[model samples]
Target: MDVARDRGAVAIDRDECKGCGLCVEACPPRVLRLSAELNRYGYHPAEYLGSGCTACGICYYVCPEPGGITVLRRQVA
Candidate 1:
């Protein structure tokens, strides 16, 4: 299996997630998923699936909570 090491990155705030699965469903690359572990709020937070984040901001846009998903877009120069 191929996993992205650091090409693209996304930061998920576990504490703020409500396990709505919106971000996961909105992710075009399918890089986000509900973590098996629970967060402080006892919800299955969205987690980065290794790599493959395109930084499209779909997850961020769909996320109901602010700052829930932070997308670090790959720099192209």
Candidate 2:
């Protein structure tokens, strides 16, 4: 997990997403948004605008493909 802005947050690679909708289905905060743009593989995957996330890792764990989701929490430094 990576840290961002001391908000216990991380970054997500929207391009790597496969649009399986599992992440969207699993997101507890409803942070992940389905992009209208489709990837090279022809799936309209999910995208995070970095606003609605609640730091829940449901999207990360439920994603069928690897790198489809990433969860970052702030390090207690």
Candidate 3:
């Protein structure tokens, strides 16, 4: 695969998220969005939509809850 074309993966801990939508708005790729389903916390969690994730970690940085979102960047070696 072309290193430049590599896409990253995003993992969100729905149970911890408060659905603040900070990460969703901060996402440059527009890959993140509020889910239709409610989490155990009764808040609609952020879900990853089909898009090119650059693994910029903007979502992780903007998240209020610690470790609520995890981003795995595709490293080119």
Candidate 4:
């Protein structure tokens, strides 16, 4: 099985997100996407694609909603 190598990870807060798509657009690796399913607020929330993240925190900075996005960088051994 082939696994995608990721330098970082993203965590999206579904409830906090307003489906603005800013983070998705700002993502450098294009690893973020809007969910097909609507959130409780009847909006499509942003989600992480599980790979290709560079942990640049662009998503977090671009997101208008506080706590909507969290970027985690991989620890160097």
TM-score of each: 0.86, 0.73, 0.86, 0.92
Question: What digit string (tens of lDDT, one per residue) describes model 3 on residues 1-77?
Answer: 34357478788988998899999999997889999999998999998775578899999999989989999887777
Taken over the whole model, the C-alpha lDDT of each candidate is 0.84, 0.69, 0.87, 0.89
Top-down TM-score ranking: 4, 3, 1, 2
Kindly state the number of residue pairs that clash in model 3.
0
Per-prediction count of colliding residue pairs? 0, 3, 0, 0
Off by over 4 Å in 4: 1-4
lDDT of 4 by residue, 1-77 (tens): 11246778999989989999999899887999999989999999999987788889989999998899989998887
Our tally of clashes for model 2 stands at: 3
* Alpha-carbon RMSD, each predicted model: 2.1, 4.1, 2.8, 1.8
The regions of model 3 sitting more than 4 angstroms off are 1-5
Q: How high is the lDDT of residue 33 in model 2?
A: 74
Which candidate number maximizes lDDT? 4
Error of 1 at 45 (Å): 0.3
Q: Write the per-residue lDDT of candidate 2 for residues 1-77, one digit (tens) a residue.
A: 23244343435566777777877777775667788998887878788756656676777788877786777765567
State, as a TM-score between 0 and 1, how close model 1 is to the true structure.
0.86
| lDDT score of residue 62 within candidate 4 | 92
| Candidate 1 wrong stretches, greater than 4 Å | 1-7
Which candidate model has the greater TM-score, 3 or 4?
A: 4
